[model samples]
Target: MNTPQQTESIKNLVENIDKGNIVLPEFQRDFVWEIKKTCELFDSIVRDIFIGSIIYGKPTFEITVREIDTRPRKGQGSRRKLKITSFDKGEINQKSQISNFRLILDGQQRATSFYRALKGIDEIWFIAKSEDDLDNEIKTKEYKDRSLEEMLYTFSLQEDEERISIKLSEAYEISKGDMFDEDIKENFFDNLLFVVAMNDAELKDNFRRYKTLCMKLGELFKSELLLSYYLLNMDNEKFALFFERSNSKGIQLNFIDILAAKLYKGFNLRDKIDELESRYPNFKFDREIIVRTISYIVSNGKDIDRNYILSNLNYDHFNLYWDDICKYYNQVLDFLFQEDLAISQNWMPYENMVIPLIIFLRESNQNDFSQMNEWQYEFIKYWYWASILSQRYSSGSNEAILQDSNVLKSIAKGIKITDRVFFTRLKSQIDSYEDIFSYSRKVNVIYKGILNLINYNSMGLTDWNNSSKLSFSKKLEDHHIFPKEYIKQQFKNDEQAISLMDCVANRTLIPKITNIKVGKKKPSRYMTELKASNEKLDSTLKEHLVPTEIVEGLYDEFFNEFIEERAKLIFDLIKKTIIEKEKQIIDQYYLAPRVQGNIKIFATYYSKKLEATLDVDSQKVLLLGESHSVSSAADKAKYTLSGKGDTSTNGWRFWKYIDNNGQERYIDEFRK
Candidate 1:
């Protein structure tokens, strides 16, 4: 049955969404409107244009529901309390007991867009009288100078006598008049340029303009009746049929959304994913990766594409392997951190690489890289480099990834297969390294991979001016060796100059502080200044893979030669770091007839020494009448020395021995 149509002010509608009086059905698709669409909704609202009508269903039977998307207030927990109603269709004597909440059947996107904007959920929404006014606000020293293109609402302001704009949320609050907190006045003043104004007349003019904008926004939210809805009184079957019919013309749900809806009866996939995201707040991999990973594991490496997942994935299988997936995922993160492959999600070249890695880690049953045998460790390392350099996962790479996963599984079982076409492709890709350019680190996998390789080779990049180590703790950026402006001045064609300037060979990671010092200056000048300030300049430059011989002559005349020489040098470093290093480890520890080493641990309170013998072919260590890998041996020593457990130590770097020339060196030095 149809109820009478009703209209609600935008302000009341937003308040209902915030207070949980309005919610969404479990089967409903998520809010998928892009920022542009959300901005357009706001534009229409301010212009007093009718957007559309919402449909709300009052369920006579019990149904699963979720709250509207809104940012949680301070002290609120991870999730809002979900409302579950208990009712029998025949037992309801009065219409008042039906339920206070209504399930949104239509206009979900429009309602969510307005709610999120008004509540300042993901990004702050603001309105200005003119583009010039917004531009002026952006020019204020306090503004971060974000790109207009990146913003949802594109507007800019110049320094003008009149500057007026109000944050949408604050406008809504002020529209309440007596309910507005007096303390919020200061915040409103701070959002404008009046905070630093010296003249009282100018301050009054700005204040007057601010009030006008706020009042306009307030009127738009309070007086304008923008939301109209049709209330439906329907049973479960009818409601389901109506929902299906209503959404027929809407955007189709993706596979993940369908999977979520199907699995919700047995296991709440969305809740589990939300829990995982809460656990690892820094992880940036999207929901697809998580779902695909579960599907891949449950399918036993058969296929993890969308069709396979949709066809075969079930709640029982997902619940069974979810814990192991989480554990292996953590190990993959640790591996990336320890190897300096990626400091964070933004630096990762191919995030899908996590799929194969998780697979390998689970099949091998290895806790960490330090516990791996030489062959297992080397194979994974080679595979990682090859996949990234060859862009193996760039496009339709599901088959390639499946094959690689199979290979990794075989290697875990001690079978070394060398004749794969992937390796040949990897070799060809590496040979063409110089042709790759560093356009955008966020988009270009090769550029990031090359930077990661350089960081791996250097162990850690060093500061250019100061000899301090560059870590993720400090702000790091990929900077050009020869300044961009200098290169532009050298070449008559702008395109050629930018091409040469942004080459992967010409870029290196340095601390942001160092980059400021090297700004727009010729390499020769910066190198000269750096050499004078730091005693170990040559060594630091070498760590960044910058050839010292070319630094002085890196002007326009020698630019091509410099790039060629540096590209070759970088290739050599990559080979030594990824390829030659693994082989050297195999030759030194696994294949060698005999090898011995001792690790000395010196603490503030005590000192101790441990001796170990490497077992050839197995890569296990013999220490204290027990067999262990070098990593376990080191862990044992650390526990003994520090009286603490849960020590994850890299044994190769910890263990050391004397060589033929009577020089002491780390066991890992053998890889050199």
Candidate 2:
């Protein structure tokens, strides 16, 4: 039997492959063909098979070869696919109709080898009539000979009837001839052949065997096991849908979603209150406590308004007493987790308390609680509520027990054992309460109390002692009480001697030199000077002090009324100091300014002239009397910038005084 021409046979096999008529599953990874390896493989086959002129079917093969497709299908689990395309019988016809020939699967390597061999050259290798040694049917006396004869008969027979008995194998073995290099056995021959293929059944039975072979040879010869396909291959809509499905991981989880999930998972509350809380993210923090407490409260069919219960209690109360509540929660969660405790609703009752309670439990150092007092526990609870409700009223971690002494004092005053018990009881008392209302009221109370303590005037103006080596007299200062501008405004109505003299309310004990420098500048402009002078002041106060820390702490508002109240307090203190100073002078000397009223007589001289001048009335007084009479207009009281006493006619002779009460007095005559 004469097989068809090799070209016609190979053409039929190529057609079969293109039409998907032949299914070749990948037995290794996808085509990783290096151009260099392909070149080498091509050169080897040409040198060994074509050049040697040995008919391909004869054994004693030193090199091995195989062929497998490298493309992958979508969703196939393996990383490699394999197919057979050639055999030992003959080369395939490249143009023959594949449907007409019974393709013996073993020749895939041979066909590929022959095709690549012929493709690189201008002429294809053909068996010549001159190589007559193996052309005749010479019988060898062995069973191997019979098997070889049987195999050859399958392809040699020209008639279909004679080919029927040949048992065709699905794989082929080929020789390296003299082309096998020891170093290239694994790197070249084994990789290109045996490692390239394993049928599906063969792979399942012996994946270890082929995987090891691939490991030794190289990955290039292995078929693609994992199938990967891109959405771009599909139509627009399918492409979009596929992309969306693949790109689902792109959406970022927001903080709330992430935090909520953590709370839900860590405590196993998915079916419990977390499910309900998921419906409204805004109420998550409040629901952290309310839902579980409500579930626990309502389990026994008690009629209570959820809103009313939350409204009366306030977050402060909860913060102070959440631990006690969690003790009850732990019982509930432990029961739920272990025994599936009977809950009021099909709702997972355990979740409500576990999330926040577990959070608290983990936050609290268990061993240290033994030494903690009731007050400490209450303080911790208050801070917790403060953090959860107002998003942290005091500084530090959300769970830190407030260590600031002032904060501790403020919170301690607000939360008492009585208030704690009452709110807990109130949880059961009210028909409906809002968590937000309770939370707001609690925060408002705490914030207001803190503000009050900060603004309290018990420290008084004396606290501005500047004991830290700070001094207004030297450092430059201004009155914070009633500014000079305010005095000027009031001065518009009253310019009388008393009114023009700065009013008691207008007085402020400040750095003296600075006050003198500022003089009558508008308070707004002077304020900039004052702020610039005080580097120790907080930057917020660098522009304005009255509305800064002092006023911000002292008054809820810095409007006129509040300013007036602070002014009154300040002026009262100033007036008392001025009165005491006047009394001291009066008790010391009758000639000095009287503590009786705001008046004092003083003497002066103008060059050679004598005059008794009434100098401006200030906190300080200077008095002088002279011999000049009331009727003497010639010497109309010339005043001199003289000190306590003058040597010109003795200091008293230069000035005279007529008392306001009609008492006439001369300086020298009175002294005599």
Q: Which candidate should be chosen as best, given lDDT against the real structure? A: 1
User: All candidates' lDDT scores?
Assistant: 0.61, 0.30
Error of 1 at 81 (Å): 61
Shift in Å, residue 161, candidate 2: 98
- Over 4 Å off in model 1, which ranges? 1-254, 418-422, 432-442, 472-475, 493-498, 528-534, 549-557, 574-672
For every model shown, what is its TM-score relative to the native structure? 0.47, 0.15
Model 2: per-residue Cα lDDT over 208-301, one tens digit each: 3222222322221122211222324543223323333333468633222322343442333334445544543322233444433432233211
- Stretches of model 2 off by over 4 angstroms after superposition: 1-256, 259-271, 274-396, 399-672
Q: Model 2 has how many clashing residue pairs?
A: 70
Quote the RMSD, in angstroms, for model 1: 30.2
Question: What is candidate 1's lDDT per residue for 1-672, written digit by digit as tens?
Answer: 367777777787887776666788877875655444665566544433456778887776656676675533212331334344443555322332543567789989888877876776634345342221233334232222333221223211111112244567666777778544335546665545423522344345445545555666677677545554334664332233234334446754356776778788787988887888788765544667777778776776667766567667788977888767876787787778777766545667887888777777777777765777876876677777767766666544565566677666656666544322334434424543454432233356677888887777777777888788776556677788887777877654644455566677888878777888887767877788888898788898898888886456545456767777888887786666555554443343232213335333221112455566655346566777788866577677657655756544445545656533222334543321
